[model samples]
Target: MRKLRELFRLRFEAKLTTRSIAASLGIGNGTVCDYLGRARVAKLTWPLPAELDDDAALTALLFPEDAKAQAERPEPDWARVHAELKKKGVTKLLLWQEYLEAVPGGYQYSRFCERYGRWLATSSVTLRQEHRAGEKCFVDFSGDGVRVVDAVTGEVRVAKLFVAVLGASNLTYVEPVFSEDVATWVGCHVRAFEYFGGVSEVVVPDNLKAGVTRAHRYEPDLNPTYADLARHYGFAILPARPRRC
Candidate 1:
């Protein structure tokens, strides 16, 4: 549901192309189009209604067919459940069983997890920091990919998404590449820098295999090609700490 809201934000506020949005979110282009189509049919716009903030509410409004079934089931206090999961030795399966014990007709384990995930997504928040212009650029790849098929041979391949964001402005650049090889990674960075019209002093990237051969807290090993790219661009490569989250 976070992706759903971001889909609306990317389309209405950022004004990115549908394909770009699909790539950035690592969803299919058809999926992006379908979401937009549903939004149009529902007459939903950016800064969605306060009443529609919850995933269940948004889902009910967007896909009304399942509303009755969903409403019939008793829902757990998701806020409390979310907080509890943070404690040691607590898991979703245990929580779901407890919920069922309390409410005999409540959602099953699968449904419980599904609802919890949706709620988690909608309730998630991101912290932003202020930085001097051109000071830092953060980059990462989406977890999924978009499919691309050959025109004549009909060979299908997955295109990875490369996303770069400026620290100060939160300005973003996204591109789809056939692979995450060192060359492709470096090329994407160059293009992103060009898109921003300048290079940042530091490039902070997630510990991607192509860019960082080995991730470390104090010092990370950069791929030779990636290192050369940094040298040529005169920007420092700062790989994000491994497993910090």
Candidate 2:
């Protein structure tokens, strides 16, 4: 369409008849007439803009310019934050808070997160790697069932067992429990940490009823006992999403 219009314009400027222009451009005579009609309606003159030498540039100039640029946040000192996160216990939220304090008129929470995510795209980091010794402890429920037996009454009960796997060593600890209640859930973590000999820097768990009271995709609510256990161990509890199950 654009090429036909340009060809008609050039031929008409050279004072050729509509039929002649159509023949030269290998288009229908009616197409040449339509182009001439459109040019007349648009009030396009023979002489075009000096800057618009080509058809592409002329077409661009016909349309209105885009809107002005929007305000944006400044880039953060990613190197410092990256180093800090590598240290024992550093969180993105904590770093963001500190950034706000240091730069009074800095980026908002959402923008800060957006910028951090962009940085992560080009980051030379491993998504999944062997954790250093005593680095992380991952806890979750076992898919298979475990049986709990009573010696005196000769009673047997099948229940779900909570399992904890160390990130570095792959050393796992399992405990059979009657229910997935809050008390049992919190108690299992305590025993698991003790069994590991020392508390880990981070604790990862699924969004189970016992651990998380409200399971939100963006922000989750950790049960009081769950938070308390984290404080006791000087670690953090990052709940995994339900989709992970």
Worst 10 residues of 1 by lDDT: 121-130
Clashing pairs in 2: none
Cα lDDT tens digits for candidate 2, 1-245: 24544554656577888776655555567756755775666556666556555644544333222111112344578768878888666888899999988877887788777656534432432333547887788998876577778899989998898999999889999998888888888889889878988888888898887788888777889999889878877998888777732
Relative to the true structure, candidate 2 reaches a TM of 0.45
- Listed per model in order, the count of residue pairs whose N, CA or C atoms clash below 3 Å is 0, 0
Q: What is the lDDT, from 0 to 100, of the residue 243 in candidate 2?
A: 74
Note the Cα lDDT for every prediction shown. 0.84, 0.72
The whole-model C-alpha lDDT of candidate 1 against the native structure comes to 0.84
Any runs in candidate 1 off by more than 4 Å, and if so which? 1-73, 77-128
RMSD of 2: 23.4
